[model samples]
Target: MKDVIVIGAGPSGSYAAYRLSKMGLDVLLLEEHKEVGKPVECTGLVSKRVLDFVKTRSIAGKVYGANIYFPNGKSIHVEKNDETIVLYRDSFDKDVAAMAIGAGADIRINARAISVKENNDSVTVKYRDSGQLKEDNAKVVIGADGINSVVRRDLYRIRQEKVVSTLQYDMAGKIEDERSVNVYLGSKYTHGFFGWAVPGGEIIRVGTGSYRASAYPYMKALSKRFGTNRVLGITGAGIPIKIAKSLFTKRSVLIGDAGGIVKPLSGGGIYTGIFSANLASERVANAIENEDYSQLRHYDKDIRGSIGVELKKDGFIQSIYSKIGDRSFDRIYGLISSEKIIDTINRSGDIDYPSKVIFKVLIRNPALLYSMWK
Candidate 1:
């Protein structure tokens, strides 16, 4: 029996297992995927502030600005002071796995968790290992699995309130522009969400996102709009979003995507996942040592308090964004300074959603502000 069983060996899982193992707890990390960070769903564009939060050096692409396009063919170029890193997600995820291994956590690759059972003080995790199934016991279970987390389904009824399915691809062609990313804020191109152009290696990570049911159609539209005919094959998938508070249960904690730590605005969960895993590991270990596990609710509260306001504000912004007509978008796009746009994408995943800041900007421009309010 281990002290903790961490399901999913991605960013969140690795961080949780690492923290627990460092504290001398027997931590077992399970990963369903054969390896970490393949079929990369992330664009890997994160703010400078993210570097301060995440403790690894796995940067691949660096960006300084972005280009925003309205539905009316009007566009604005924006710049930022902070540098955002666009990493090769595969390398980054593998390195994160290394961190867990360094901390002495027992990692089982290709181990898919089947089910989990919790009885008062202990949790039993049944998983398939090396073509054979096995069951293990642990005092605590942390679900760090990605979007379609089995742990969440098995443990609790996760309310699907704020989830958006995102589709993206790592293309092979050389991007014409690599320094500044591209974003389209029109529902025609991407329904109820937006589309993006992220630079990775020699390919452009182009994709779109929306609510789950609409994701496939929206992604197809984006494919047609982005010159998919000229492009090679595309990669796509549903990105789990945590637009609201997460579900936490007894003797179990859901971290990262499993817990819905994704950015409400950008649908970026990598940074939030790692950060939550770190906190969960530390807090869970502390609880075990002190024999006071009642305050497990703190995990959810702490994450929400640190990131909730921003996420809520961004959610509101995205709501206003996807509804805007072409003409309204043009006026608002004009009101939105290039400086603001650049700064937004660069640091969007790190700090609070700039709602208060947007309010101030709107006050300066009445017509644009009024549109947002509506």
Candidate 2:
């Protein structure tokens, strides 16, 4: 039996495998797809903190500012000192997989994990590979599979609080502001969330998300406004919105989307997933070395103390965002767009922890806080 078996070769899973393998544990990494990364589902816009995880060659472009548009036809441009990196997700995934492989982890492509059964002392993962069924036993199992993770559903039998349907397209066109991403907010356009146009070098990525309705109509409208119909690629999927009740249980643990640990406001999971996976790896490694699987509970506690704090803050912001009407949004926009408030946002804005600037802005313009609630 191997020391660990990681289901899914995505960034989170691969990073966990990489860290565990580097710590002298025997790890097996499994990928469902024939290739490492394909059929991209993310917009690939991430904060600079992602650099702490892996070295990648998939950076497609960079932006230093954002233009947030309210429903009233006015917009607010917030510029930051640091640049956000746009990546070609396929290459990014492959880069993380390479690190895992180089760290002495055994990787298996075209291997789809169908079910995971955990016993008193070990975990058994049954999978399909090369048209045959197979099983592997390991001391521990990490579920980084994704939004519709089979391991999470089969093992925990739990679901996320909500799932947002998303639609995104990559279209080749000359963007007006290549240095800034455009964010559109309106109930008529995107019912539950927001829409965005992010420049990716020669192309632009346009996307949106909704609660129970289809996001395609909103995405089409946003794309049309940007004057882009020369579509290069299209991707659609459901993104889990909130964090799960728990992340680990005995010999099995969940990381990334499998644990529903996405940013409530932006739906970005790359940095958070990789970061959580790194933490899980440390705890799992310690548990294996001591043969005490109960130590896995610390993974959940550690994450809750660290990133979980940020997620909870963002969740409160999202709640305010979803409740505010368009008229109130425009009024609040007027307050936030002022030079003083804009300066505050520029000084403290952080995509990884957006609440930092938000609380500061609210403190400077207390009227804006009232508008958001009204």
Candidate 3:
């Protein structure tokens, strides 16, 4: 039996396996895909703090100090720090996987998992190794799987609801200014979700999300708006929108999407997944070493204590956009600066509606303070 078996080799799984491997634990990392990060699904727009924590940093593409957009041809511009990075998602994943392997975890690519069985004190996972059936026992199981996690089903017995579906493309484009992240709101702009323009010098990451069920038709609709069909390279995927209360269990714990840690608003899962995986890896390892499952007791509290309030505020933000209509988004983002945006992102992964964060943003842009009430 392995000391830990981390399912899914995404950011979360890789982080967990990496951390535990550094601790000298018998860790096994699993990835069903032939590659670690392919068919790049995420925009990879992350805050500076995250890059600092992982010690895997990225350079800026083009920083926009403020947003430039208008509703009814009325434009508003807000200043920003231009610190956010536009990383190659595939490269980032491969780097993270390398971090784990360097730390001494055994990673298995092309290993697909079908189901998990927990018996007595240990868990056995049934999966297909290339093609044949295979099983592995673990003293502890960390579900680092993505949206469709078998680990989540085996442990939490919870279903993923309210996932955000999206499609994006990387194409040729060079913008003179780089500090602004272009955001568009209102149903007229993006149907079920909103469209984003994260500029990467000559490349652009353009995509939208889905709030309501049965919105598959919206992807094609959005592609036309972004002119992705005309682009040479276009790619997209479904990210499990995690709006759950909490995602930890008795003996088993879910990390990343398996734990439903994606943003309530953006469906950005990489940072949240890595953050949660770090928390879970440390807690779970301590629990195993000390023979104490009690530490897993407040796993939610620890994670929420870190980023919960941000998630709640994001939930509020999403509600406003989903129901309030389009004209509000440009102003909403303009009022919030890059610093405040990072603060919200940093804190939201842990909790819902952080009052302190709201207060800061309100102070910065007093006008929207009323909208917070609205």
**lDDT values for all models:** 0.74, 0.89, 0.70
Report the CA-based lDDT of candidate 3 relative to the real structure. 0.70
In order of listing, the candidates' clash counts read 1, 0, 25
The 10-residue segment with the lowest total lDDT in model 2: 220-229
Candidate 3 has its poorest 10 consecutive residues by lDDT at 345-354
* Per-residue C-alpha lDDT of model 2 across residues 215-318, encoded as one tens digit per residue: 98898888788574588888988888788888988888899999988888899999999999999999999999998999999999999999999999998888
Candidate 1, 1-374: lDDT as tens digits: 78899999887888788778988999999988787776566778766655664566788778777777787767777666666788777777888888889989999998999899888888899999977999999888898877777778788766546667667765665555677788887766677678888776667778888764566676676666546555654666666555435546787888888877777667877777877887787778877887777767787787777766666677777676656666667767766655754454444423335565565565555677666555
Q: Give the Cα RMSD of candidate 1.
A: 2.9
- Best-matching candidate per TM-score: 2
- Which candidate's lDDT is highest? 2
RMSD of each: 2.9, 1.1, 4.3
lDDT of 3 by residue, 1-374 (tens): 88888898888899899999999999988899999987567888776556755666444363434343434434444443435566767878888899999999999999998888777777788888888899999878888888888988777777887677676666566443566677555554455566677777667666667676433455455456545445656666666765456566656688888877877766777788888888888898898899777677667787777765566667666665566444455456555535655465344322223345555556666887554345
